[model samples]
Target: MILQPDSKVLIQGITADIASTHGSRMKAYGTNIMAGVNPGSGGQIYHDIPSFDLVEQVVAEIGAIDTTLIFVPAYQALDAALEAIAAGIRQIVIISPGMPPLDMVHLLRKAEATETIIVGPNSPGIIIPGKLLLGTHPSEFYTPGSVGIVSRSSTLTYEIALELTKSGIGQSIGVSIGGDTIAGSSFLQWLQMLDEDENTSAIVLVGEPGGNSEEAAARYIAEAIDKPVIAYIAGRKAPAGRHWGHTGTLAMVVGRGEDVGTAQSKLAAFKSAKVPLAERPAQIPELVKKALK
Candidate 1:
């Protein structure tokens, strides 16, 4: 299941420098953050929340954790994520700004076998307007409505959401699969799930010049989805030989750089699928309204 309001939540690096700020905000936003886990800081309460050394401790005492937000640094992300999965946490969101690509490879392989869902190695996180907050997403920019949002760029995610809200179009859910070239969830995964979501009437997919994720999503949207879908591809003028957000891109890029399709190609893919394309953020709401028609 996607992160829910009632999910027993834990912060793996809750005592870290950045954790307390976002932790407090997430709690204030009404996420059921049940516990905090900082290996050496266990038994010491932080942010007025109980702290534990291990995920199992949270499970044994506070009950099973449904989701975890990891704030550990890039080096520790793999260990922290592995521990959460080992403790039966199904949904893991890595809010770390960077993680070794090889580390992500190992973590993703483990996640696949365990059926764990990883959100980002450098993601802003997920938000359901007027309901739940999971990462660093700006909640004030979002309003509750029927459009479901999925994006690969952090800046564009907020920009697109604010455009919808400004146009009086509220969102059912907004997700940043992160800026990484390789992420846990894909456009196809979120597109499929949002298509099934009862509250979502349409979807806004934000893409950039990267791997063929957009192309794959276009195929799925054309063949499988009955819901109205809108596409917005970023980096229209980016040099075709390069891609943005290189944290994870550099890893897979070596073996499959050619697979990183250009923004022009992505725009073409969505157009070919006959999906409405938004050339700019401001253009999305009108396109969204058209799709929902």
Candidate 2:
């Protein structure tokens, strides 16, 4: 299930200094962060939330957990995620960054076997406007409305959301699916969810140079989604064969000389899909208005 306002959440590695910091902000946003998990830190209270040493313990304490926000160190992220899965926590958002790709491969395999939905290993998590805050997204930049935002960059997601708020275009949800090469979710997945969300009237896809995700999304939108989609592909001037901030944004070769992750290639995909493209963040509002028309 998609993250909702009432979804019961657990924070893995909550005793860590960084987790405590974000946990405070999450509470202020009214999130139902029911419990925190930190091995050996169980029974200790942090930010007024009870802490547990294991996911199973937390589950035994509090009923069923719907989602988990992982804040453990990169090295510990794999175990934290596996623990959540073993405890029947199907939906997880990994907030820790720099997790080794090999670790993600293992976690992703298990998640797939169990039908778990993971948001990020390095993601900012999901925010449902005024309803809930699951990760570290700054809440003030968002407003409740009819638009949906899905981005690969956390910071860009905030910037665009703020721009939308200032332009009177509020969002139904803003999701940062992480910047890693292997994310738990994809743009198409989030786009499909937004298309079915009654509160979402349109969509904004913020992509960067590198991966073929934008191209894949463009293809899916053309064939599946009926909603108007405004597209923005960053790193238009970025050089080829370099990682652009996100691990997933690194240019790579797949086969016989196909440049799938270039900005020009992704922009072309959007063009072919009949989706309107945004040259700059400031140009998005007008494009949204145009699409609605």
Candidate 3:
């Protein structure tokens, strides 16, 4: 399958077990939720959809071709993640949290080995307004527009869209790239798509403290791109050696005299290259408008 932006999706792991915890939000967002997988829960119903015991059964019965949101437990998350990939599922969105770093590394390697594209082991998944919504985001937060959004923070992505909406601007595509230290895709990959998209007038990137992915993206922007980019890095004051929330929010220094891992300094580099920085989240709308003008 081509995995067009509007393809059908199946959501696994959405049973009474996890539905009470996470599945409810996904259903509320208008996902097909074709079937939930919870061992003996097959034949059970959730949000009016039949539950299945395994992904193979769901795929065979429902023919959901494009995407999946893996909400299984951390211990079994890797197996579930690999299963979806092995089944030739194109876009798998992982919403489960607390995945071990080694597991994520292994999953990424497997994904590379299989040529599969995974979204998050700790992500909000992807949402293309009015077409397909396979993630945990509230539908009301987004509207259709020309700017494509890709961020490491789901709540912050919502906040940015909310700010954009208040100014009568909306998004073309909004993707939460997950805050994990090991993620399937990068902001640059998303940016390349957004840059080539005729519907996308500009791009907004949201970054956090952990890795230099944002910094590398900034350098890419400095080198190329006729499109304007507005960036904001969160968790500036995050203490060293204490990566509390997001996996990649802590900076790593290779050796002495190396400047790294601070959101403020990382974001400051953008200003040097004329990339506008939002002093605060509230300023994002204005910064985007200014960038376009």
Candidate 4:
């Protein structure tokens, strides 16, 4: 589900301020933004892009759509996603944050059944350096290269990407899976994709404390991934038992003596898997260079 420069994109809820602003930026970046969807705002023009009442309407009038960038309010995000799925959009990126967890569960189920790929419900989206920008990532921090990045924290993703770019280490693709507890995609899923991506020489996995996602990815990398994987787990100094912004960044009890979801636990998982761990965002480029060697 890597968004290519040629991928036709539709902006759901494009009439909204956030969506419209980013839509214009994406268009200026030379993205093939075909249309925007805004129920009653249909037949109107937003930032020079056509608006539609529904994704189906867009498809019927303009033809097939390859991907959808969702910017609807949190409450309407699920509906927009379902509508895109129903309209046969295979790839969708939900940028709105704080969506209800249960709704995401339902959306994930439907997406899985339909073989659709949903990037985030609270994400910064995906960017392929100068090629494509699907979400709200700051493109100036990125440059075309061979390092692929998958992060849970959007801010940290940008920070590390900037470090990489400044250090002359560009990226092949960078995607923020969102910091939510349950995302439509997983670290392992993206890792597998990067493993298969010939353009990606190595992968940088930016994980946050509080969630077995990093642990799970560690186990998978040890067994399945062949590419060199550099990892950095955020919230290293975060207090235990405290809930972070993302649902997945909350500590939980799983077994005796196991501080599941803690930063130490995730770090230990990476250590056990023999994956190099970056002490800080700035240290990531060095680790990436080491891995490439």
| Winning model by lDDT | 4
Model 2 worst lDDT run, 10 consecutive residues? 249-258
What TM-score would candidate 3 get against the native? 0.89
Which regions of candidate 2 deviate over 4 angstroms? 248-258
Clashes of 3: 3
When sorted by TM-score, best at the front, the candidate numbers are 4, 2, 1, 3
Candidate 1 vs 2: which has more lDDT: 2
Q: Relative to the true structure, how large is the alpha-carbon lDDT of every model?
A: 0.86, 0.88, 0.74, 0.90
Tell me the deviation in Å of residue 119 in model 4. 0.7
Model 4 stretches astray by more than 4 angstroms? 248-258
Native-referenced Cα lDDT, model 3:
0.74
lDDT of 2 by residue, 1-293 (tens): 65677789999988888788888888889888898988889899998889988899888978899999998888989998998899999999999888888998999899999999989878999899889999999999999999999998898899999999999989899998888887888998899989998889999999988778899999999999999999998899987766676565433744423366888899999999999999999889899988988
Candidate 2: which pairs clash? none
Q: Taking the tens digit of each residue's C-alpha lDDT, what string does model 1 give over 177-252?
A: 8776568888988999999999999999998887788888999999999999999988888765764654333423
Mind sharing the TM-score for model 2?
0.96
For each candidate in turn, give its C-alpha RMSD to the true structure in angstroms.
Answer: 1.8, 1.4, 2.6, 1.5
